[model samples]
Target: MAASLLYPFVLLAGALQALGNSMNAQLRVALTNPWLAALVSFLLIVFVFVAMAAVRPQPFPEKASVAAMPWWAPLGGIAGAVAVFMGLLFVDEIGAGPFNGLLITANLLASLAIDHFGWLGMKPKRLGPMRAGGAALMVAGIVLIARS
Candidate 1:
């Protein structure tokens, strides 16, 4: 699929993420334990992904392919779990708008730095004026959200 066509899906995914964060916060309260809530939430994700992989029936990676992967590659899932746990722990205390705004601002800044430095094997994209301006605007937006 072309990148243009994926934009709507990305927008939808963002909306769903906001919803998920709120839901997860409630789940934490209902379960009365942060660890248990996170475990149950991630277990559902694991089961769904496992079911999807089983249905898709992709070819298994060869030993050489697996061996060639970076050791940190698997850390992506751990990083995601940290994000989910943050949502479960903090979203209720801080409203969704402020929480998401700060989260997105941090994500944008980190992404800009990653692109600028070509970190993690990504091709370097210079942080030109336009990108910097966009980031400034995002910061302003976050400030407004946080203040409100």
Candidate 2:
């Protein structure tokens, strides 16, 4: 599918992500322990995925396919959890706008590097002038957001 066609879904996801951070921050405060809050939040996710898998069972991955996976492949969840944990710990302190701004700005910067280098099996896209300009604009926007 063309990326433009997919853009709305991504936009919705971004909006939901910001909401989730705020909700998670509230969860942390209510629980009074970041670790417990994160666990409760992620445990629900685990249950939902497990239920989905059970309902629509697929063949287990072939041993060869499993063996071919990189060691870092399973770490994606860990990385995401770290981000969530940070949000849970700090979102209320920093306020949603600035926190989300910094988070998204960092994400964009890292995404640019990842795309430029074609890391994690992505197709290599050169850091051309337009991409660079877009990144600069994102940084500028984040600065304005953070200051506001």
Candidate 3:
């Protein structure tokens, strides 16, 4: 029960996401296109990973131990990166707070659906009336913020 008190982790995650979005918005302003922005961002992330690895090298699996994953695996990363950069640009045209509020609302709804259906092998959660009502309120808030 005490472990469950880590619920604040959700708030921390949201804060980190908001911070990441702000950085992405800044990068979007510097780049000409979303694709270019994503590319640069990806390169920077890879560079950071390499630098960390240099400081603390981790064991790598043998080539034989690696199995080919579905092509969709890599495509998913590419798609996510492209979508984030594009979303940043779209939201920047409006406003960061509004865009983030709507985006967070969308994420909440999507997570609810995923939890309800247990998509991708996730454990399904019962979506009671309370959860549904809360989701509805979130959507309403997003709409109000967007319209403001």
The best candidate by TM-score is: 1
For model 1, where is the 10-residue window of minimal lDDT? 76-85
The deviation in Å at residue 45 for candidate 3 is 1.5
Q: Write the per-residue lDDT of candidate 1 for residues 1-148, one digit (tens) a residue.
A: 6799999999998899899999999999999999999999999999999999998989888999899998888898898788789999999999999988888899899999999999887899999999999999999999998987
TM-score against native, each model:
0.97, 0.95, 0.76
Instruction: Give the alpha carbon lDDT tens digit for every residue of 48-71 in model 3.
Output: 999999999989877764565444
**Which regions of candidate 3 deviate over 4 angstroms?**
1-6, 54-76
Residue pair clashes in candidate 3: none
lDDT of 1 at 93: 97
lDDT of each: 0.93, 0.94, 0.78
Tens-place lDDT digits, model 2, residues 23-95:
9999999999899999999999999999999999999899999999988999999999988999999989989
Q: How far is candidate 1 from the true structure (C-alpha RMSD, Å)?
A: 0.9
lDDT of 1 at 24: 99
What's the candidate order when arranged by decreasing lDDT? 2, 1, 3
